[model samples]
Each structure stands twice: as C-alpha cells, then as structure tokens.
Target: MELSFQTVLSQVMLGLNNGVFYAILSLGLAVIFGLLNIVNFVHGALYMLGAYVALLGYTMLGPLLGKPDFHLNYWVALIVAPLVVGLLGIGVERTMLRRLRKFDHLYGLLLTFGLALIIQGVFTNYFNVSGDAYDGKPESLEGAVNLGFMLFPKYRLWVIGISLLVCFATWFVIERTKLGSYLRAGTENPELVKAFGVNVPLMITLTYGYGAALAAFAGVLAAPIYSVSPVMGSEMIITVFAVVVIGGMGSIMGSIITGLLLGMVEGFTKVVYAPASSTVIFLIMVVVLLVKPTGLFGKES
Candidate 1:
C-alpha cells in the first residue's frame, strides 16, 4: 500500500491528538508525584468525573435555565469542569488520602484503585450505559483547516495547541515561579516549609486538586473528540501511566515532550503498521525501562 503525503499528515494529526491527552494526564500524575509523592490511581476516575459533570451541566441548564443547546460552551466547560473536579480532589485529600501519606506508595495506589472502582460503579449504576453518551460535537468549531497537504480537524488542532499551552504553562509555573519554589521546597522539606509559615498540608491539598483539575480539563477537551463515559478514564489511564514512566515521573517538561513525541510515533505506527498500534506505547516503555530505567528525561533520586 502506498501512502500519500496527506495520509501521513492526517496520521500525524491523529497521533498528536492522542498525545495531547497523554501529556495532560501524565502532567497531572507528575504534579501529584512531585508534591505528595502519590501515584494517584484515581486520576482516570477524576477525568471521567469531569466529563460527566459537563454532561450534567448541559442537561441541567437546558430546562432549568431555558437553554436546550445540548452543548456547554467549550470555554465554560474548560473552566467549570476543572474547578468542580479540583474541589472533589480537595475533599479526597482531606478525607481519604490524607492519612495515607506516611504509608507506603502502594497504599496510595490501592486506595486510589478502590476509589476508581467505586466511582466507576456509581456512574455505571446511574447512567446504565457504563459511560456518558456522546454529547455531540460543538457547533462553533466543527470544520477543518487546510494544512499543506491535509485538511486537519479544527478541534483536533485546537486540542494539540491548547493542551500544549496548558502543559507548558504548568511547567513554567512549577519551574520558574516563586510558587513553584515554595512547592518544591515544601516537597523537599515539609517541616521546614511549614515552620517558615507555609501551610504545607494546604499546599498538598491544592496540588492534588490541581492535578485533578488538569485531568478534568483534558476530559472536557476529550468530550468533543470521544464520547463521555464512566470507563473513559479507566480505559486511557494505563497507557498514560506508561507514558509517565517513559518520560521520567518527576519531570514536567519530559512528560509533555514525551507525550507529544510518543503520540506522533503511535500515529505513524497506526498508518504504517496497524496491528502494533494497540501495544506500541507499552512496547516502547519496556525498551526504555531496560535501557535506562529512569526514562528519556528521567533522573535518579
């Protein structure tokens, strides 16, 4: 089979789209790992929660607010979904995962894993579809744009660009700002930071909230591409975790870059070797682990 330039371009776009989600999800993982040192197995559940929240918002507003548009403003969902999910994260931090910090990382993982099951089960119980129905496409951004060779879906392009912005902005805040310094310092010496008058526990709470917010934001973006569903987060979280491992868990920039690069690689693999596409990320992770163990931009602790 011959591949045209347009075909290659389209495949590249597809890969980038996947990468965008990978980057965002992995970025959240990185943040939680950075401050709290937890693996956050419930992140996927939080992402699913975001989508469900948006779906609920659209539905509730239709009759109550006299708006039956069937689509929440993408920009509005972007803001509201994260805030709602972030608040939930704060609650989780206070109630469920707070005391576990002094325990083994496995405890956090198992706790989150159980939480994931509960969240998914509740959604499945109420929704009856195991996932939210596709809310349908946003009308405002439905067309395609002409690239050099291929016409790219406008929203896919938006996903790539907007996710990149969020990723880098997050990295910049963590790496270059005073808030970041306080965060890193608190992580390194929580007692000292606390003595210095920083509320270390509150910081921890916010950090997890921020990570959940990031996942939710990604979910809102995803609702436009894939249908919202309870299992959506569970489905993609494994691959994203592999992505985090391959990028080195602690590095924000590494996660973003690796996400985009791996996405492109997966896209090309799909076009060139469709059979390998499913397990491609994991296969790469295995090789990376054997070679460096720390990952592409990983450093030893």
Candidate 2:
C-alpha cells in the first residue's frame, strides 16, 4: 500500500489513544511491582470497574444532579471512580496481599490472577460482556480542532496531554521527592525501613491502593474513547504487560516514555501495514530483549 500523509496521521492518532492507556496502566503496574513486588494481575479488572462505577453513578445520581442537558456527569465519575477503586485496593492489600508477603512471587501472581477472574466474571454477569458505548461525553471537551493538516478531536488531544502530565508527575514523585526516597528504601529493604520507625506494612498497603487507583483513573479517562464493558481491559492489559516488560520494571520513566513511543509506532504500523500493527509491539519487545535482556530501562533483579 502506498503510504499517504493523512493515513499516517490517522494512525498516529489511533496510536496515541492506545498509548494513553499503556502509559497509565504500565506506570501503575511498575509502581506496584517496584515497591510491593506484587504483579497485580487484577489491575485490568480494576480499570473495568472504574468504568462500571461511572456508569452506576450516571444511573443513580446523574438524573438527580445533572445539568439541564443530558451530559450524564462524566467528569464527576472520572474523579469518583478512582477513589472508590482505591478503597477497594486498600481492602485487597490488607486482606489478601499482606498475607502473601512471605510467599513466593508466583503465589502473589496466582492470587492476583484469581482476583482478576473473579472481578471480570462478576462484571460480565452484571453488565453484558458484549460491550456498551459510554452513555456520556463531557461537553467541556466536545468538538475537534483543525490542525495544519488534520482535524484533531479535542478529547484526543486531552488524552495525550493529560497522559504525558500524569506520567511526568508520577516520575517526579517517585524519583525526586522525599517520600519517594522512603518508598525506594522500603522496596529495597522493608525491614530496615521499619526499623527506622516507618510503618512499612502501611506503606505497602497504600502503595497497592495507589497503584490500583491509577489503573481506575485510566479507566475513567478511557470510557469516552472506548466502550464501557467487562472485556474492555482484557486485551489491553496483555499489551500493557508486554510494554512493562519492554520498559523494565525498575524504571518508571522508562515505562512512561516507552509506552508513548510504542503507541506511536503501533499507530504508524497500522497505517502502513494494518496486518502487522497487532504484532509490532511484540516484535519491538523481542528486539529489546535480544539487545538488553533486562529490558530497556529495567534494573537487574
């Protein structure tokens, strides 16, 4: 197929959309893995749950509190869904993850896997697995802006910009803040951090909650771009896993940058070679592994 500029630009937009999720989800996964050493297989489910919660909010409260237009209060859902999921994370950490601290890493992985299955199943049972388009879109972000060469959706631009901001904020907090120093210390040696009068267990619990919250936040952002469904996260989660592996678990900045870059690459592939887009990320992962076994930014375990 002959490549056209418009085709490439369209692909880039699609890729940026994918990149938003990858960047956010991978960052959350990296944070949890780095600090708590938990794989958090339930992250995808948590993301789906965020969307569901927003829907629930719309169903119950939007009518009573909505503006004159039928906007359905998505902005409120975007804020509240994550908080609800964060609370759930706290409960999971306290009840399940804390108990597995002394077990093998595989145990944590299996446990989280089971949790994912459970959450997904429950959601599928309640909400049709076939998927439903989000009922609401924020009017504040409606319409498209004319770029020099193309018209870009305002929401799409918001996704890309907000994702970048979130990623950078996460990196800054983890890499440059005093709290981050303690977090790193806890990750390296929880016992020592505890000895230093820190509440290590509490910190670990909060970290997981924060990670889960991040995933849920991504879900809220994603509801408008994609349908809200139980299965929405299933495939994307697998792709993000590959992204995390390629970026390296030890480097938050690596995950952020790699996610966006890969998203753009995937989009370009879709434009030029549609058949190869799905596999392009895996191909990149293979190349990275061959060149750097530990991953692009991952530290040696």
Candidate 3:
C-alpha cells in the first residue's frame, strides 16, 4: 500500500492524540512516585474508574434527577469524574497506603496491585467484560478542520492543545511555584519540612489526590475515543509504565516529552509495519534500559 504525505500527517495526528493520553497518565504516575515513593500500581485501575464514573454519571443523572432526556454531558463528566476519582484516591491513601508507608516499598506495590485487581473485578462483574460506549461529544467541539494536507477532528485538536496546556501547567506548578517547592522539599526531607511546620502528611495526601485527578482527567478525555471498560486501563497502563520508565519517574517534563515521542513512533510504525506498532515502545524501553539504566531524564541514585 502506498502512503501519501496526507496519510502520514493524519497518522501522526492520531498518534499525537494517543500521546496526549499517555503524557497525562504517565505524568500522574510520575507525580505520585516522586513524592510518595510508591509505584502506584493501582493508577491504571483508578484511570479505569474515572472513565466508568463518567459513564455512570451520564447514565444515572437523568433517571435519578427525574428528567428522562437530561443526561450528564461529557463536559460535566470531564470535571466531575476527576474530582470523584481524586477523592477516592485520597480515601485510599489515608486509610490504606499511609499505614504501609513505613514498611518496604514492595508492600505498597503489593497492596496497590491487589486493590487494582479488586477494582477491576468489581467493574467487570457488574458491567461484563465487553465494555460500554460513551457516544457524546460536546457540540462546540463536534466538527473537523481542513488543514489542507489533512482533515483533523476538532475534538482531537482540542485534546492535543488542552493536554499540552494542562501538562505544562502541572510542570510549572511542580518546578516553579512555591507550593511545588514545598512538595519537592517534602519529598527530599519530610522530617525537615515537618519541623518547619509544614503539614507534610496532608501535603502527601493532597499530592496523591492531585495525581489521581490527573489520571481521571485523562480518562474523561479518553472516554469518547476508547471503549469505556474495566480492562481499558489495565491494557494501557503497561504502555504508560514503559513511558514512565523511558521518561524517568522523577522528571515531569520527561514524561510529557517521551510520551509524545513514543506515541509518534508507534504511529509511524503502524504506517511502516502494522504489527510492530504495539511492541515498538517496549523495544525502545529495552534499549534504554540496556544503554542508560537511569532512563533518559532520570538521575542516578
């Protein structure tokens, strides 16, 4: 099959859209790992929860509110799902994760893995494994743009733009702002930060909440594009973990850049050789590990 410039451009755009989700999801993982020192295995499940929450919200709102035609829209789900998931993250942190903090890090990983399984299982039991559809797109974002070389979906372009904005805003907060300074300091020396009268525990809790919110936000953005299902995150999270590893867990900007690059690589691979698309990122990861174990942006321990 001969591919034209337009075909390549469109594929690249599609890849960028996938990259936006990867960036957002990996960014959340990096944030949670940076401060909490936990691998957050449940991140994928939390992400899945976010999508389900949006679906449930949209499906239930009308019936519960006694208005048959009045369903919760994507716009509302975009805001509400993250908040709901973030709060659930906070509850998990306060009740479960906090107790295991003093133990080996593996404990936390194990606990979160168990939690992930439980969450996925519950949703699978209720919804069945096939998955649910979220068909609505906001009216304002419902069209396509003729970019001369390619016709691009307006919603996808919006996703790319907004995702970049959110990712950068998050980077700025953690790297430039005063609150970010506090978070960084706490990560380095929690005892000292506490001695300085900072509520390090509360900050940690909030940080986890914030990270979960980021995942949930990604989920909302993804609902229209992907099937809303229990295993959605389970499948994507592995790729995301590779993104985090390649980008390094400690660098927020690294996650964003690596994700976008890998997404494009995967997209390009699809054009060149269709079957290699899924495994390309993992191959890159193996190369990175063999060459620089610290990752592209990670610091040596």
Candidate 4:
C-alpha cells in the first residue's frame, strides 16, 4: 500500500486526538498522586463513568424522567457528566479515603482497585455490548475541516483544541498560582498548613474531585470517537499509566508533552512498521526505566 503525505498527516491527526485523551487522563492521575500521596486506582473507572454518564443522559434521561420527548443534549452532558463524576469523587474522598490516611499508602491503592472492580462489574452487567453507540457529536462539529495538508474531522479538532486548553489551564493553576502553593504546602505538611487557617482536608477533597473531573472531561470528549463500553476504562488505563510513568510520575508538564509525542511516535510507527506501533511506547518505557527510573522529567524524591 502506497502512502501519501496526506495519509501520514491523517494518522498523525488521529494519533493526536488519542494523545489528547491520554494527556488529560494522565494529567488527572499525576495531580492526584503527586498531591495527595494516594494511588488512585479508580481513576480509570471514573473515566468510564464519565462516558456512561454522557451515554445514559442522551439515551435514557428523558425516559427516566418520564418526559419521553425530552433529552439531554451533548453540550449539557459535557458539563453535567464531569460535575456528577466529580461529586462522586468528593464523596469517595470524604467517606472512604479520609479514614485510611494514617494507614499505609497501599491501602488506598487496594481500596480504589476494589472499588474499580466493583464499578466495572456493575456496568458490565448492564452494558453487555461490544460498545454502546453515542451519537452525541454536535451538528456544528459533524463535518471534516480541510487542513492545508489534509481534511480532519471538526469534532476531533475541537477535542484537541479544548483538551489542550484544559490541560494547560490546569497546569497553570497548579504550577503558578497562590492556591497551588498552598496545596503543595498542604501536601508536604497538612497540620502546618492547617495551623495557618487553611482547611487542608477540604483542599485535599476538592483536589481529588478536580482530578476525577479531568478524567470525566476526557471521557465526555472521547464518547463520540470511541465505543462506550464497560471495558474501555480497563483497556485505556494501562497505556495511561505508561504515559504517567514515562513523563515521570507526578509531573505536570511531562505527562502533557510525553503523551503527545508518544502518540505521534505510535502513529508514525504504524506507517513505518505496523507491528511495532503497539509496543513502541512500552519499549520507550523500558528504555526510560533503565536510563532514568525517575522518568524523563521525574525528580528524585
């Protein structure tokens, strides 16, 4: 099969779209683990919930509300789904995570892992399809836009733009603001931060909620592109963990850049050698671990 420059550009674009999701999801994981010192194994499950929220809102909201003709639209679900999932995250932090702070960090990991399994099991029982169709792409974003080199889906372009915006905004808030300094301080010494009148517990809870919200936001963005299935989260999480590791665990900027670059690498590999596309990132991971176990941008703790 002969490939053109346009074909190559298209794959890069497709990979960029995928990279955007990875960047956002891994960003959430980085924030939670970097700040809270908790290994949030349920991050992927929350991402799954985000997609399901969008799916059910469009398909069943009207019926569930007894207004058969009315339905939740794409724009509303984009906002509502994250809010709903973030609230659930807040609930989890308050009720379950708060109690285990003094215990070993492994407890948090185990608890979240158990919660993830339970959530996946429940959804698996209800959605037993290869994937649930979600026709929620807004009409404005339905067609393809002509780039100078190639035509790209307008919805995908929107996703790349918006996801990038959100990721940068998050990085800015955490890396450059006064509130971020407080969060960092709280993370290092909560009692000291509390002594200065900051409600560290509330801050931690909100941070976790925000991280979960980021995952959900990615889910909403992804619904139109990927199949909404019970196993989607489980499938995506490992790759995301790789992204997080490669970028350096808890790195704010590393996750963003590494994910985009690795996705492009994966895309380009498909062009150069199809079989290596899937393992290229892992191969990179292996090399990075040997070279700098702390990760590319990861600092030694």
Q: Which stretches of candidate 4 lie over 4 Å from their true place?
A: 1-3
Runs in model 3 deviating more than 4 A are: none
TM-score of 2: 0.94
**Residue pairs whose backbone atoms clash in candidate 4:** none
- Consecutive 10-residue window with the lowest summed lDDT within model 1: 128-137
What C-alpha lDDT values do all the predictions have?
A: 0.88, 0.86, 0.90, 0.88
Q: Write the number of the candidate with greater TM-score, choosing between 2 and 3.
A: 3
Poorest 10 consecutive residues of model 3 by lDDT? 128-137
Q: Residue-wise lDDT of candidate 2 within 17-127, one digit each (tens)?
A: 788789999999999998778788899999998888777676646466754344447877878888999999999999988898888888888999999999998888888
Candidate 3 lDDT score relative to the true structure: 0.90
- The sequence of per-residue lDDT tens digits that candidate 3 reaches over residues 176-279 is 99999998998899999999999999999999999899888888888877889999989989999999889899788999999998888888888988898999
lDDT of 2 at 250: 87
**Structural similarity to truth (TM-score) of each candidate:** 0.94, 0.94, 0.97, 0.96
Query: Any runs in candidate 2 off by more than 4 Å, and if so which?
Result: 60-72
Which residue pairs overlap in candidate 3's backbone? none
Q: Using TM-score as the measure, which candidate wins?
A: 3
Model 1 vs. true fold: TM: 0.94
- The whole-model C-alpha lDDT of candidate 4 against the native structure comes to 0.88
Candidate 1 wrongly placed segments (more than 4 Å): 64-71, 128-133
